[model samples]
Target: MSTFGTLFRVTTYGESHCKSVGCIVDGVPPGMELTEADIQPQMTRRRPGQSALSTPRDEKDLVQIQSGTEYGVTLGTPIGMLVRNEDQRPKDYSEMDIYPRPSHADWTYLQKYGVKARSGGGRSSARETIGRVAAGAIAEKYLRLSHNIEIVAFVSSVGPIHLFDPEATPSSDPAFQSLLSTITREKVDSFLPVRCPDTVASGKMADLIAEYRDKKDSIGGTVTCVIRNVPAGLGEPCFDKIEAKLAHAMLSIPATKGFEVGSGFKGTEIPGSKHNDMFVPHPTKPLSLATATNYSGGIQGGITNGENIYFKVAFKSPATISIAQQTASYTGEPGTLEAKGRHDPSVVPRAIPIVEAMAALVVMDMVLQQQSREATREMLGRAARLVPELSRQEEKAAVEGVEKVLEAVEKA
Candidate 1:
């Protein structure tokens, strides 16, 4: 269950307060240039103690490539990586042995496994995401070099404050669409503490997080992610829609409460006529089509349509606050618990990279799966000829024919 993906599989190990936390990334394409340098940047971004907004755990998060590479090139074998735990303090979590912190994984993990880790939240800790970010870096490298795909995530909201007005429809707004197409990680990181791109909103969000931190509490927020240049037809239909896999990957992250793509729930308020994405000819590609609207989030009929894919992930406030709370123990005995640990008052800032990583994982896996399918289809040839393939000229003629018919109807 710890492993994810079908082709580009990743299995992560270790836990908070353990020796180290890392992951084994399998199915990297052979002979591509790879090293710790490519992976370390994201690890650094995801690491704790980066600024006053996050936990002061003081982890360098320096990743080391243990195997599956030679002379800085991946060897088509499982890539092993590790990051040592340097600043662990198991004694800080000694009180958690009896009372499971409210809304934390302690109680449920105990009920499921019968025995839980004596310190920290075990696998539920944000430290476990280091492996995901590392593995994602590798997948991202492959995608970037091969397809020029760009993935970026930024904090879009903190508590009730939003980067855009709550009533504004993001999918229909030209500014939001332009932001999705142009916003980069550099632009995102420049506004630290809160990664919102809007200068004014970022300031407000940071102050809100600081207010909660000073009160020894936590606040929740949302991160909006966009992926550009994803090739068309990269998802399975029925059970494994691209959006479904994306939702699954995102919700797996700790503290993530909800997931939505494109217009998301807002689409439900409009009728089908307004919500539908009308097809238009791609500006640069002769035979390809583009969407006039992206209410479907660049995916239609469960597959990507070569448009920018965007989504929002909602993260709950960190449950392990330093403030004292009245709660019950494993034995159901009432008591006061003052949780001790270094945790972010707001997680969306650091969660940006994690969101990007998970999105990379989902897209990479889907890409590989689609590639395999295409390769097999090519090798087998069209022996059955169930559906005849259309030539480029024929496709163009068909589009012109449709256009002429529509024009005649308009004239009538």
Candidate 2:
């Protein structure tokens, strides 16, 4: 289950306290220009020690491209990458041996595997997302170069403060639509620490995180991601819908509590007439259709509609706080557990790149599957055309069927 995607496969390895953490990415198109530098920016953005709002775990998260490329071009092979774990403190987690931290994976991991990492949460740690971010960077580069796709995610809410209230202002509101259409990473990062984009909201969110950090507590928040210029007809139907795949990928991240697409839960409050997205002629693309409204969130019937795909992911507060809590040990014994670790007071600020990365992986895998189907269909169409006798016979049958239908209607 560590491996993700059917066509564009990514398998990640290594735990939190392991020497290194990385991933092997398969199915990258050949001859594409790629390098470690292209993948490092997002990795650095996801790394810790960025600010006081995040964990002070000093990791450069410097990525090294180990294999599957030469001379800056991808070789259409599995790309191997690694980021060394330079700042691990095993002694900090000695107490984890006795008492499981509340709302953490320590006890469940032990129950599932009959063993757990002595130092940290192991695969359950947020450090596991490093591999995901690295693989996503590669996928994102391919998506950008091939399709001009742009993926941007920012902290939309921290605690009770939101960039805008979804209940009061639906996603169909002009202001929210404008933000989704025009918000860029540069504009998002310009408002640092919280990355909420709105000056007033980001300021308030930062102060709220500071309050939690001071109190030795933690808080949860939401990150909204927008993907643009996605080609239509990318997602699969039934079980593997794009939104379902997106939810799968997103919830796989370390603290994600919920996932919602388009207007999400708020749309439930509106009548169908208002929630519905009406089809209209595309503004720019001739002979194509676009939705007058976007309650569908750029997707209809489990397939993309060549519009912006936006969704929000909610992450729960980090469980490993410095505060003391009443909890139980591995045995049936009551105890007071005071967890120790350099954990983020709030994960939303640093979760921006992680959300964007997961989104890229989902879209990239779906695109590859779609391209393969298209290529196969094109080949079959060519074969069908080469058989002139079969083609003529089929055309005559179609004409006869239409004539019969017309005659039946006239008789009626």
Candidate 3:
């Protein structure tokens, strides 16, 4: 049930402070070039102890392929990977062995599953995001190559600390691919704690984190993501709508409490006429269509209309603050507990890659679905145009492909 997607499905596993946590990618296209190196950067971005703002849990987060790949190429099978839980301090959470952490999933998890892991947050921890970011790297590659699509996500806010202009934000302006090529270990280290591109905001955010750290408190913020160059007409209508799928993906991430596409909540303030995206035929190209406004967020009638797709997500403050809070134990016995051990005072920096990954995952599924449907439609149209001359095999292939596309969409 934790899995998402249709063509390139991914199911995340493991828990915080477990032996390991990872993901299984099902339905990825074969012969795509991939390796641990391809996934390492994203994993590193999500790893802990990278900066003064984050948890002090220093982890290499090294990814190891367990199946479905050979010699760095996908083998048309389920790709299984594991990132070992190194630098873990299980004993730090011993106080909660019988008494669950307040405001965490301890009671709910036990109530639903009858048992819970005592160490750290177990599966509820943000540590689980390692697999998602890794898998999303691959999904991003597929989407880029297949559709010339690119996804960009950045931390737009920290608590009430907002990055004024995105272009002014240092990390906000770089093409992630280009940045990847020039990224050095030294550069990576210097950017850690908070990955704000704007040095001024970064310093301010750093100071704020230090203040919060001293106070043993936490803060929340928002992340903005953009998917560019997506072709018009992806995503099915009704239940399998593209926006619905994206909403599902965003909600799946830990601590994500709010989601809004282009002009989302703001749209509520505008009239329907003002909110509607008016079609504007391109002046230079007759075949191309655009919209004067992107209020629809590059989607209309549950399909992509080929504009920049943008959205924002709000993450609640990390619940695992060091400050003491009052709550009951598993038996509803009230007591005071102060969270200890390594934990991110704020997750904005680490969450950037995770959001990008989820966006990539959704876009990849949409692209594949679009390709299948278009291929089938083209074949059918050709056969209908050349009736009685269509080959038997062509007819059968189109039928099969259409059926597969239908099945996938239905499942989504």
Candidate 4:
């Protein structure tokens, strides 16, 4: 499904090495402030060649808002966006046409569609995520301005260099809550090259990636994402759970292999008595609900429960490696292949923005769906307020013999 969401829907288009890449974002509320300025930073963040950790391909990825806005405000129309592709090197992937790279989508894409783009990994490339990041910026803008919700993602692990202690409380104390609420993208971007928040671990991760890059091999890593200020009842029940949708989004990214939330697989080690979240009165908002423990990752019964929603995304090693490997050709002849292309040694750092973007898309869609419910309740309340308890009209009708029955019935 190239298109995503129901109300705040977005459909991404174009391919890697194509003329342009972008998306059309639909269902933006009218009069909301929007512009390319609000969306470009994310695109830039997701761009490669920002540092030594990523590929050398540097596409400016400047987003151009083609339509659906006037004077820096949304018009409630389909917002058309575009980013032209520069720095194309089709020659870099010419060998891939005959000798399919191992563990890549090239073989599968051909098997499924009978043909595939031989340049720059095509639709299967990480470049495909540009559209997602662009649309996600728009969704994130609305979410932040209207609801005060915030999303942040950072490199959590690169080959077992964990930045966070798994057993430690994700929310340490009131100070942690304060920081969680106040943490900004600026702080995250401050940790460039390897988006890990811990300087020591980040340095180690950077070294490891450098070692891998020097060896012409790729390594896998993980990203941790957090959603803050998510209100209760944001997710649809049953199959379309918020966590499930989040899993879908994370897995949709190129080279992602696994996903987990909260305590994740480790939570199983604890007893039920120890793992269950205890409901308590909110610390700041009296009479409101909260949890003493967030083992549930702020979600229960597939709905958000007014707590921090956090999860981890596991990325697989990049399939294309410069290391010579024995592989079969498209014609079934055995051969040695030297994969040549500008690719990341690790995707975690660059994937941070992509993770943030996908989270924004999911949360924005869920928020819009929840907003419809809020609107319905408000409309019903207004209708009830405008009517008498016995269905009496406020004013009498002028028609003869055929009077308004509601007022007459109430008067009687």
Model 2 weakest lDDT span, ten residues long: 164-173
Task: Give per-candidate clash totals.
Answer: 0, 0, 4, 0
List the candidate numbers ranked by lDDT, top first: 1, 2, 4, 3
Candidate 4: regions farther than 4 A off: 165-182, 386-412
lDDT of model 4 at position 359: 97
Candidates' lDDT values, in order? 0.93, 0.93, 0.80, 0.88
Q: Candidate 2: which stretches are off by over 4 Å?
A: 389-412
Worst 10 residues of 3 by lDDT: 165-174
Task: State the weakest 10-residue window (summed lDDT) of model 1.
Answer: 383-392
Residues 1-412, model 3: lDDT tens digits: 7788888799999888888989999988999999989888888877887767778888999999889888989999999989999888989887786577766787788888988887878788888888889889999888878777777666667876776543332222345323432433344336556765557767788788778877998888787777887888888889988888888999889889999887777677778876777889966667888887677778888888887787888988888887878877767778888877877778887888898899888888888888899999999998798875657778898999999999999999
Model 4 over residues 225-315: C-alpha lDDT tens digits? 8899888998998998999999999999999999998778877777889889888888899789899878788899899999999888999
State how far residue 411 of model 2 sits from its true place (Å): 56
Deviation in Å, model 4, residue 266 alpha carbon = 0.9
Residue-level lDDT of model 1, residues 224-304, one tens digit each, is: 999999999989999999999999999999999999999998888879999999999999999999999888889998899
Query: What does the lDDT read for residue 22 in candidate 2?
Result: 96
In terms of TM-score, how similar is model 2 to the real structure? 0.94
